[model samples]
Target chain A: MARRPLQEINAGSMADIAFLLLIFFLVTTTMDQDIGILRQLPPPVPEDLETPPVKKRNVYEVLVNSRNQLLVEGERMDIADLKEGAKMFYTNPNKDPDLPILTRQTRGAVEENITLLQQALVKDPKNKQLETDLKKWKGKLSAIELIGEYDELPTSALISLQNDRGTKYAMYISVQNELSAAINELRNELAQDKFGVAYSELNPSVAEDKPKIKAIRAVYPQRISEAEPKDISGN
Target chain B: MSKFTRKGKKGTPAVSTASLPDIIFMLLFFFMVVTVMRQDDPKVSISKPNATETEKLEKKSLVDYINVGTPIDTRFGTEPKIQLDDAFAEVVDIQFWIKENRDRRDEAEKPLITTSLKVDSDVKMGVVTDIKQELREAQALKINYSVNKGSALDNN
Candidate 1:
């Protein structure tokens, strides 16, 4: 007897199988993004170190109580008004004596200061502290020259954020967002004036835009200091 | 006889579907490449707070998540709990978790790892503070407070 002829299996159902898998994956996939406010925490302080003294005028104190009430610079303030208040404190455009002091240093002065620090380093070549100071002074000089605006730089001004343990997380984040927005707003203005672009528009990953970003940041540095929470919880 | 004689009656020619499976497979592969499978199903329910100044986390692999919210499991109680990886964890378990996470990464990428805190808005600051303190001790200084993009003024 002759051998039975071979029969080909149907492949018409393959599309249906693939369709089932595609639907399964489409339903199961989550396109949620990962985004947030980036922050760097201060390192643990050493036990034997002495606390540095900060002047009352130099610190913009922001306190949030257990009830989520905001006390900004010893005055009760609504959360909505925080950004404007922070911008005022940082910029001090009017040079108000009550606000943080802004030291107007010219390019000549910074260059001279850098020379003096360098001369001091020459005497004690191994002085790491002096070397760092020189480097910082040089950076300031570049920043001052890069930004053609006024030489007014916040000498010692910083925002001190303090909160009660019972404060709601949403309130805390709101405060943080305001503070960040304040700095970013200032940077945007400065970047717009100097570089003809917003601060956020400058790509930090690019080599040409690095100095522009650094200059803007140097002009309005984010000096928010998050202090340890006090025992103000109602519970 | 004409070269073009009338053809005999015949049924309509069927449209070829030989390429249908290939097209489906192409779509399947597209979804497979673009899809990021959920790594850990969060046991805690999280509703992130809103913020205006949020930055997109660039590298997902370099970020380790610490979820803080009310647990979905009622047996654990309604109080805000910390979820590390697959299970609920205490504040103290953070250090060990950080170490384990660090050990699994490449040496060069270890320092770049960021700890993203996915905390519910309604949770108290105390729990968040405790986690931050533990993170500082663990020397995982870089952190991202995960939040949705919205106006801070709207929060008030």
Candidate 2:
């Protein structure tokens, strides 16, 4: 019996199969680009823990009620202006000398202290006191520089975000985002002014420029303190 | 000049069908890599609020989603509720879920895990705050408040 040669499989249908699969995926697939505001929740406090008293001047209080109305530092404000308001509060550029000065001294004193520490360190390389003092002075110098540019030192400014229990989630998130944007804007401005680079371009993965970014972050750390949700009806 | 005239005479020679499959296959692979299947079908309708200062959640694997919105089905009632995974859950369930998710991850990766709260704009802050408190107790501090992109001026 003569064996019939195997028939050649049709290659023409391969393209059709590929097209079918492609279309199936195209119909079912959804690209996930998850974008949102990243935040770090404060660690839970003990019920017995007493709330520390914050100076009225230092605390930049932002309140959102059930109606999504904003009460910023006791005055009504629009959400559109929250960023600028937050920036102004954080930088406190026109810092009244009459206001109780926190530990921060004049910018000249910080700079002079830093220079003296550097000279002392050079004279006594093994002096741990000199090393620590130099570090402290350097930190103050950055804070001073940040204050000089933004008006208020970032470290000294505390943002307290409070919302009513009945406040819409949308309003709460909007306020939080605005506060973050203010801090980010300040950082970006500092990065641009000092390093001549955009804040988005400052990658921690890059070794050489990491310190510059770290210094900026140290100066304008995100200091949002979320207060417990209050009952609007009760108050 | 003579070679060019001869090539033009063929009039685009049936535009080779040989690479058709390869082209289609390339697209298929591209979609396969980029496509992320919806992990949980939301039981409640969620219309997220918009914000200008949004950051993209970088690692998908390290993120867990907590959805909060009013139930779409009438049987569940008109009031808003929290949906953990596939089922309706209370605020207290957040700690349990966080622990379960944390346990599933490798010890080294546990710290990087973030809980993305996809809360509906219409939901009240009371529920969200409760959820946040539970998360804090569970030591899942990192959170991403999921929102759509919108201009700051739109708040008005």
Q: Number of the top candidate by DockQ?
A: 1
Give lDDT tens digits, candidate 2, residues A83-199: 998887766666654232334456787778888888888888999998988886676566555434323353445888988888888888888888988989988998898788877
Candidate 1 segments whose C-alpha is farther than 4 A from its true place: A1-17, A20-24, B1-14
Q: Can you list each candidate's DockQ?
A: 0.71, 0.61
> With candidate 1 superimposed using the best TM-score fit, by how many Å does residue B89's alpha carbon deviate from the native?
0.3
Kindly list the per-residue Cα lDDT of model 1 for residues A16-111, writing each as its tens digit: 999999998897677889889999998877769897787888899999998999999999999989999999998787887778877776888888
Error of 1 at A90 (Å): 0.7
**What lDDT does each candidate get?**
0.89, 0.82
| lDDT at A55, model 1 | 85
Least accurate 10 contiguous residues by lDDT in model 2 chain B: B4-13
Error of 1 at A229 (Å): 2.6
Each candidate's B-chain TM-score, in sequence, is 0.89, 0.85
